[model samples]
Target: MASFPKSPFPKPPFDRQKPQDPPGRDADMDPRPDYGEASYKGSGRLADRKAIITGGDSGIGKAVALAFAREGADVLVSYYDEHEDARETCRLVEEAGRQAIAMPGDIKDPTHCRALAERAAEAFGRIDILVNNAAHQKTFESLEEISDAEWEVTFATNIHAMFYLTKAALPHMRAGASIINTTSVNADTPSPQLLAYATTKGAIQNFTGGLAQILAERDIRVNCVAPGPIWTPLIPSTMPMEKVKNFGAQVPMKRPGQPCELAPVYVMLASPESSYVSGATVAVTGGKPFI
Candidate 1:
């Protein structure tokens, strides 16, 4: 087992780095967010399962993908334009003796989402798990700072794509399959600076709750993971430098969560053990109450 610090970060106040475009590169991150490359050990919980994970390029998505691969699941890593990060995720999956397919495109587009579903069906023969883990976020200090286009794109990338991809993937999903979405603490406690992103996260929680019931009759489980401040590429790319420096200080742990810390919960949600669990939001908030 790999030992971790109290904060899961190298230091309390992380060193400031250059501003990156949306969905920053993990390689360029100062601390290089851990994705359980060395610590994670699997026990065939998801043996032979087929899974599709959006945003599998880095952070939570990458960590989940690694855990799934280690558990003997074939993974299809769907990502945006982050080829380098996506490639590394695929390499990890392959290293675990599982099939890995790197498919890159914009999930904001409905057509691309359908294509992702079709490709997964073609490659994996069927879809056993769909992880709607990709999202786009850019912080705005005030309501006025958020433009009309910005508002629309956040919804498109965060919530709308989840709908489209879930719809497209359902046809291939069988009973006992799982759909795990990545919501956030922002869904419960909206962040004023991330108004648009928070709004979409709320929508996602609603969507997850409703869909869980709708699919329950079919025996298909639906759930979401609500993470607190996590040390992911999304932070530095979207939030201001000051906020980035003090990231996760608000939580009781007074530190951001590492991506690897979230893998076990995802593994439980995807495996057969969660057969009776649906419409549940598992909060990985580093000791912070999710409500």
Candidate 2:
């Protein structure tokens, strides 16, 4: 194996800024997150594979798409109307000499989730990897502030969509296939402010564990990724300006992780290199232990 230089991580004391929506744009972020465009040397770990990645428009999802492309996998990026961000991700994947399909729709809808899988199969012949990474989060002072609608929407977008997409994609997945769900540090240490989001993450972790065992006989691997405070557009968009400025201070590293920082872990899970790895929650939390 060859050694590669590490990408630069942003220092503490970030400037306060916010995007207008729940899922923010990468272009709008002040200190743009590193998505391994100029780094992440690939050795064809996922050569000739086909993958579907929800929320592949930006942030952690985009980083994973780029890495998968570089490793020789064709990707289908599913996002929720982030046209520009989705296009940019596709462009990066294409630049890596792989196919990139950008499909814009709401993953919260079970119908749409199934359509995404069908489209991916139609475009790529087979689905080798399925990454349920799209998520929704909002901050509320207390439970009283969280409405029933808000709670339902959170579960619909986060956990339910994962179930829908996985069910749809399983038919296309054969032996040695991989399914990677995006859980969060909140699963182990829930954040009261993000009550709905945290709860869904907890469910996702359990879902991954159960699904892994259920599919073991089929030779399919299932796992999840739990990330801590990654410097993504989601921070400025959903969190308060004050919280955004000090987003990752609680971690021992005292800085939020960059999306690029988590790409390698995703690539490993998607590749044959992790054939023996399953039912595991790989945490990329910048020194924050998931346990």
Candidate 3:
């Protein structure tokens, strides 16, 4: 019998230093993430397009901003309060030889979300892509530990904000526009400790599909990307320190993914390269099964 082909991927240099934040810290993370600003060559995949990305200040959002800039799009990064992170992301975008604007505000409010869309449009003269990637999650020991405030805030940040921002952006978007939402692997995996947060993520998946069909006639595509455990500031900022150390080990790959590795999917989904793809969820989880 012929032996199965050997896997080609080499062992990743996994660093085991304890991440400082509950969600994780991009600045102090061992083996800093790949930004691809200098190396990723673009054939103008998103040239002349303008993009607005929520939570673009740090983590996966920051990675996507830099990638989009490299792909020839002017990027508007909407962030909450991480000024330093936002500035760093802006610098990377500028380094890509594209324009980047860091707009700081709370996305949970409809007015702020609308303003972001409008301002991005004004600054770039058009809005072609929207990436709803900002999210907040807190660990709970049990279901009862999830308070009403937590539930509301989670939905506000994760789901409601997406709805509000997309609605505001639609008018400015012409045919061939794209909207990308950031869901999570926990949506399908359903962690008991993250019941509320996972619920919002699952809603985002269904929301993406339903909205895609509604916007199909207008030629605006909607989709979601569900990432597995990634080394981002959110891990150190939200999870227990010890759990943060072993965050991605549960995946089949036995290591967490980096934000840079997952950034291309955003570009693919946003660019004309994925013209026929919509109502889809691009799974970037390391070896995790997608349902």
Task: Provide TM-scores for the models.
Answer: 0.97, 0.97, 0.91
lDDT of 1 by residue, 89-131 (tens): 9999999999999999999999999999999999989999999
For candidate 3, which ten residues in a row score worst on lDDT? Answer: 6-15
Residue by residue across 54-157, what tens digits does model 3's lDDT show? 99988889889988888888999999987888999999888878999999999999999999989988998889999999998998998788899989999999
User: With candidate 1 superimposed using the best TM-score fit, by how many Å does residue 39's alpha carbon deviate from the native?
Assistant: 0.3
Instruction: Give per-model CA RMSD.
Output: 2.5, 2.8, 2.9
TM-score of 1: 0.97
lDDT of each: 0.93, 0.93, 0.85
lDDT rank order:
1, 2, 3
Full-model lDDT, candidate 2: 0.93
TM-score of 3: 0.91
Q: Write the per-residue lDDT of candidate 2 for residues 43-161, one digit (tens) a residue.
A: 99999999999999999999999999999999999999999999999999999999999999988888998999999999999999999999999999989999999999999999999
Query: Model 1 scores what on Cα lDDT?
Result: 0.93
